[model samples]
Target chain A: MTLEAGTTLPTQTFVVRRADLVRYAGASGDLNPIHWSDRVAMAVGLPGVIAHGMYTLALAARAVATWTDDAEVLELGAKFTAPVVVPDDDTGVSVEVAGEVASVEDGRATLRLTVTSEGQKVLGMPKAVVRA
Target chain B: MPVDASLVGRTYPPTRPYPVSEAKVRELAATTGADWDGGPVPPTFPILLAFEAMNAFLEAEGVELARIVHGDQKFRYERPLRVGDVLTAALTVASVRSIGGNDVIGTTSEVRDADGALVCATSATLVHRGGAA
Candidate 1:
């Protein structure tokens, strides 16, 4: 089925954990203490160590991919708005997605996405172009 | 102990070709909660291949991975990558400088296809924390 422009895809909700942050730090060659150590993070300028912006955006892309059954993601762009604080509580960090198909034709779809936390948009202008 | 300035402007030999795959792309897409439209590959996918190139460079330079930080990354693409494409990525030390007892290293990578056609250019800033003591 061809996705028409303005068609809203399924929303995805997930959390970020200290373990996942550490693993991403290793895999991506990013080891800033602010990403893994809450004490260090608080010592710096954050409430606590937060997930990498790319990591969070990566999950957002998964939302679009799952909707279309693993179609090719042509391009994606995002900007980090706020730190995803990893609290001591095991609840971790929650990410919610609200997006719609911006355009679609010939097995291709462009999605405009917004990611929020507690009514505040943390990731603004989330966009992706994909093809199946 | 700053990163060797002599490495600047030096272009390393291209690393072994890495093949792009559908399954890998799907995995990345799954991780991002993205929907693929069956079009071109995601822009960030090549970073997976580039990471290998970066690792080889670090190994050759004797740089410790634990001490490095990815300060920034930017990708400029001419076209999308497709599955089954055998691509080569060559890393070059573009610039370097010392900052507050640390070393900031800049690197550029050019990715090309088996036919030697340029596909994309990536620039990254690596902060060598505490290397310039």
Candidate 2:
């Protein structure tokens, strides 16, 4: 993929359900109850069961891989600005990831990503640097 | 409870070595709806090691996992992680501050290979919610 400055990559949407959170907890070893148990999440002042921050970030990484054909990721980072509440339903919620090539220099492409769920931005300053 | 300010700059011991296997890589990828074709592991794959270090730190400090929420995370890679790489993460408390009765703790973990070569540097911010006043 030829990434140039100002190029917008295709947007990707991921459906996050309660089952996915359980799978992620096992896979990543997070096991934070807020990510699975609605009772614990509510006790901690969360609206309901929330997705793991790393899981949401992983969706962004998936978008990067799709855009770059799994290019060598030199850097990836993001701030968890808001909680993505995953309801206990089959359909779940949709998290959308969109990116634009901020710059490309020295064989690297810097991407600025916007991740959103429930029409609210979920990640702050999500960005990735990949070997082009 | 707020994290102790004195904890800043304190580095914890390196975590146990984690062997990167293809099954592990595939498992993480599947969570994100991706299929691992045995190429470079996903960019955020090192979080498994970092999270383990954080868990150890929290356990030692008597912090409850249910009271904490993730605030931020960042990863800078020296090279792509591949299968068969055994890695460990050494964590350091970077900063601590209180905001609106919540303790925001900052930590940075260095992910190193078996040779102790830095493979990635990952930083995370954890927000510990205070009990009712």
Candidate 3:
């Protein structure tokens, strides 16, 4: 079954955890206090430690990878307009992705992915280019 | 508050080459939940290359690092990045402005392969969280 352009994939849910957030901070060398320090993040006006925008963007990329059998996920990008504040209560943040195949040709496809949390778009205007 | 708008249109030299390793890409993939064995680098992987160039340019300008927060980032690609791809990234200060106790800086970066073919173009916005409103 070949994935065609404009084909929308089912939404998958993911829990965004503080521990994962910390790992991302370390991996990306973006040790923003707001990503791990609940107290500091709160002091800075966030409800709690928020997941980095890139983390959410990564989830969108994951969807493309899964859809394309781990094909090259080229040029995924977005604007971080809002912070995803993860509360300390242990109910990790949830992200859902709905992807549309924008174009397909010669074993390569472009997917327009929309990632959301609590009904709000997390990775705004996300897109990916995948091979096969 | 004043922004050094003269910095706009200034193109910094290409940054030092960063060897793209599978291990680093795997780690980033795991962190972002992208497939580690995607056979090619994950999307957003170019950010590291672009950010490094941005960092050097900012340091050369004496910009206070501690005061800046990443606001937004976007990337467009001509093709996917693969292992063994040696690339050079250059940054240009696109715009700067003072906004409510912060300095909003915009920058653009172009990444090219060893063959001088454009691989990716990235744009970013950072908010310098200093100064009084």
Candidate 4:
């Protein structure tokens, strides 16, 4: 697919709840308490059970992968700016992801991702380079 | 607990070769909500290997894993990795600095194939909170 500079990709939304976090913990091998145990999270001075930063990263990556249609050949990066505090409610939090084609250079397109949760930006300076 | 400046630039030994499995990939995809579109392994899958190396680095340096928070992450792939590729990863402490009573550690882990060809590299910033008080 040909990507033009200044192209804005379709925005995607991902829902992350407690069960999803548990599954991700098992899959990713990151059994951090802050991601699962509210008591531990509180002890550690966190608001509550927060999703793993990597989990959030994974969500953003899915959007990029879906956009590029070739998740296999891409370089993705993100900065964890703010925590996505996941309350223990049945309805978890939703992360909205939108991307812009920052540039198309040398057969590679760099996408800048804006990831937000609860009306606040959760990731900063997120970027992905896809060989299209 | 500051990451000793001397630890910077130190590369650990290559990890045990891990053969990526399709079943594992499917499990990861199901859990992470990734579409099982039968493409290359997810770009974030290297974390399995990177985290292993990271635990080794922390243990060798006497850093408590419980006190650390992941600050950021990035992955650069020479090419996409696929299932059945036997891979190994070598980790290096790329940089380290302290800010506001916390230690920020920068790490880069090189994932290589059985033939030592580069596959993907993962870089992460770990923040070690200074104290409990």
lDDT of 2: 0.94
Off by over 4 Å in 4: none
lDDT of 3 by residue, A68-100 (tens): 766655466777766787766677788888888
Candidates in order have lDDT scores of: 0.71, 0.94, 0.77, 0.85
Cα lDDT tens digits for candidate 2, A29-114: 99999999999999889999999999999999999998998899999999999999999999999999999999999999999999
Quick one: ranking by TM-score, best first? 2, 4, 3, 1
lDDT of 3 by residue, B1-133 (tens): 3347788899999988767788888998888665576476777778788778867876787765444567878887887787878888999989998877677889999988888898899888887766432
Better of 3 and 4 by lDDT: 4
User: Residue B23 error for model 2, in Å?
Assistant: 0.9
Residue B76 lDDT (model 1): 57
DockQ values for all predictions?
A: 0.19, 0.93, 0.53, 0.73
Which lDDT value does model 2 have at A3?
A: 90
Q: Is candidate 2 or candidate 3 better by TM-score?
A: 2
Please tell me which predicted candidate would have the highest lDDT against the true structure.
Answer: 2
Interface RMSD for each of the candidates: 4.6, 0.6, 2.3, 1.4
Candidate 1 chain A, run of 10 with poorest lDDT: A23-32
Evaluate model 1: give its lDDT: 0.71
The regions of model 2 sitting more than 4 angstroms off are none
Give the TM-score, chain B only, in order for the candidates.
0.91, 0.96, 0.90, 0.92
Task: Tell me the deviation in Å of residue A115 in model 1.
Answer: 8.1
DockQ of candidate 3 relative to the true structure: 0.53
